[model samples]
Target: MLEAIDIHADALKRAALTAGPAARVPNCPKWTVHDLVAHIALVHCFAIGLAMNRPAKPAPPPDWEDLLGWWDGQRLALREALGQDPGSPAYSPYPGFDVTVGDWTRRMAHETAIHRLDAESALEEAPETRFSPEFANDGIDEFLTYLAPRLGRKTDIRVTTPERTWSLGEALAEVDGPADDVYRALWGRPHRASVTGDLAPVEAP
Candidate 1:
């Protein structure tokens, strides 16, 4: 998770730096590069506070001109917090579960990766999207296990990727695509993947 976070965060920083704060993000139509950077930085700070069980005062958004530097500091702090014991009790938005530091670590990794893609989309030529099969597979698992249940969807859905196949509930529907695309689709990103059978649209949290 830490490695994934590092890779994605670095890529995101590069994209933001290259695009400039004024550039508009294609994926997040309403946000400029500055807003995307600020959003991810704030999320990292929130995750860090959760992992360390520390209550943090809300921080004002960084100046667009200095957003990169501010994000760098927040990313460093988040990485440090994620290195702590995974089993340590931490604050989680989910109820009826004792979410741990490790949970936040994994969540933030995917979170950062997705936003990195959004940042890359702001570039003149977007970078190729790549995720290790393992990380992509786990991302699918995390979405199914941790997030889907919260949506009150009891219907079964089967998802297939080149590397593996898995199902949620009883298999009322099936989604098939490359692992990375499937992961993105599950996260509410636009994709050309095919979905068959009876299944409601996957909503982003």
Candidate 2:
């Protein structure tokens, strides 16, 4: 989670420097660079607050110049919260998972990473999307366990990458690509062509 957070923070910082506040993010068409930064900052605050078992009071969004610093502080608090017992009770919007602080750490890591990619795409110079093999694999598992059930399809599913292969459900749908690309596709990004499967399209939660 810490590593993912570092990568996410760095990417957004670079985007802010290169694209400025007015650039449009292709993946998040409704938000400009500034809006994207503000959104993520608020997310960080919300996630950290939840992990700490704090009230869900919303924080005021920061200006562009202070955005990075605000995010840095939130990230630090989240890391501290996550360092506590993994089984510690926490509030998750997805209560079906009985999520804890540790789960929030992983969820926020991916959340930040994906949005980081969005920020980079706004600059028209997106870096290669990469995640540790383990992190990517775990993300896939989480999606299958928590998110896929909502698709209401019991079709067999196969997902493969250079590092590993995962067979899920009972139907014969298949998806194959680099781990990062597959992850993005599964998260409702427009990278579905990277995968070949009978899976129905599902929107990200």
Candidate 3:
């Protein structure tokens, strides 16, 4: 999981640098690359704080000049915090889940991955990054099983991929494609999956 986090985080940094701070992110339409970078850095810091059982001080986003460096530091801090005893008690961002470093590690990995796609979208070049089938399946399961409920999403969608199939809600709709496509679709990211029903309800929060 830590390796996944590192891979996505580094990829996100590369994409952000290529896009430039002023470039608009296609996936997160309202955000420029600068905004996207700041957001991820802040989130990383927040997760780090949680892992350490220390509340991070609320502060303005890093200046554009320092953004990447600041984010890199936070990412390292998060990795260190999460690399501690996996069973260590920690506050959970999601309710009704284990309050442990393991959960935080999983959350940060997905968070980095989803935003990594956003960074890629900010670039004019075609995004070459890809998620493996197994990784995508785990991401899909994490969203459907944990995030959807928290967001109050009632979408009943059945997702099928070459790797596996999962039922979200009551499975009123079916989306078919590769696991990565299905995973991105659930997160409202660009995907090539085929959908047989309304996808509005299944949209990520």
Best by lDDT: 3
Candidate 1 pairs with clashing backbones:
156-170
Candidate 3 local lDDT, 28-55, one digit each (tens): 9999999998898888999888988786
- Of the pair 1 and 3, which is ahead by lDDT? 3
Off by over 4 Å in 1: 150-155, 170-172, 197-201
lDDT of 1 by residue, 6-30 (tens): 9999999899989999999998899
Judging by TM-score, tell me the better candidate of 1 and 2: 1
lDDT (10s digit) by residue, model 2, range 1-205: 7677777777776876799889998988888988888887788789877887784765645676677678678768777877788779887565454668777777777778778878888877677767776877777766766546644435367788788787765536677887777788777665643556545543354
Taking all chains together, the TM-score of candidate 2 against the true structure is: 0.82
Ranking by lDDT: 3, 1, 2
Q: Model 3 clash pairs?
A: none
Candidate 2 overall Cα lDDT vs. reference? Answer: 0.73
Task: Tell me the lDDT of model 2 at 102.
Answer: 74
Per-model root-mean-square deviation over C-alphas: 2.1, 2.9, 1.8
Give the whole-model CA lDDT for all candidates, comma-separated.
Answer: 0.82, 0.73, 0.85
In candidate 2, the residue pairs with backbone N, CA or C atoms under 3 Å apart (3 or more residues apart, or in different chains) clash, namely 155-171, 156-170, 156-171, 174-197
